[model samples]
Target: MDSYICQFPGCFKQYKNRCNLKRHEEAFHTENKKFQCVHCKKILSSKQNLKEHEFIHTNQTPYVCREPGCGLRFRHGSQHSAHKRIHVAIKNIVNRSSVVSFKLSNIEEDIEEEINPKDMMDFTLPLIKRSQDYILPVI
Candidate 1:
């Protein structure tokens, strides 16, 4: 039988066939959905879902902001050109209904101000480091 390769980008692990991919997803990703979201405390069925869920943490919106008192928001600013608006006020921040937020201590600024790309970029990262050296296995 031809080797079944996991098609997910960066997942080089090959299986006996395509069925193995399903098994891998079930065992390592889907089976243990024990880790819960800290803010909304939602259950995650897989790492991909967990990663996507993190966008809520930053209140990211990829769609055109069309409501009144809105400018525009997109997962990528490139989509801004596709947006058409008539009556929305200039928006300083993108509004996402499901995002979780908390007040900053001793700061009068609105909590929305905390929705910063600098802070959010870290959470979106897949890995903290890429090292050529590998850790030695314990005896």
Candidate 2:
């Protein structure tokens, strides 16, 4: 009997045939996830989905934008990166202009001082509302 091995790193489980190995790979290594959330009991389709779902239960936003005044936080890295791109575009526009080149740190400090927690809360409420409109219905 030939042993078929899983090629995934750290996954050394072997199978007796190619079909069994394929089944094992599909069941374990594939993006398909079978785990259910203990809190909401929501069935996430993948590990990444589960991670993002878990964040919905917490108030913490781990991915924070570091572009000075833009203290916006995101639950997902992709969302944060998308937001950063906006800043990059703005910086490029400013660099090309003949106007006084303003340092983001200096501008950010002034903006940060004016922005309060209530202001942030007000800004986020609409985003939360908009996000709800796009949420996929639970299957």
**How much does candidate 2 score in TM-score?**
0.46
Q: Which candidate number would show the highest lDDT if scored against the true structure?
A: 2
Q: Model 2 off-target regions past 4 Å?
A: 1-31, 99-139
Model 2 C-alpha lDDT per residue in residues 1-139, reported as the tens digit of each score: 7899999999998877897677567656787658677789987655665676688888657899999877999987668877999999777665544233234445777788787788776674333533321222222
What TM-score against the true fold does each predicted structure earn? 0.24, 0.46
Q: Score each candidate by Cα lDDT.
A: 0.55, 0.71
Candidate 2, residue 124: CA error in Å?
Answer: 42
Each candidate: RMSD to true structure? Answer: 23.2, 18.5
Any residue pairs clashing in model 1, and if so which?
62-75
Evaluate residue 134 in candidate 2 and report its C-alpha lDDT on the 0 to 100 scale.
23
Residue 7's C-alpha lDDT in candidate 2?
A: 98
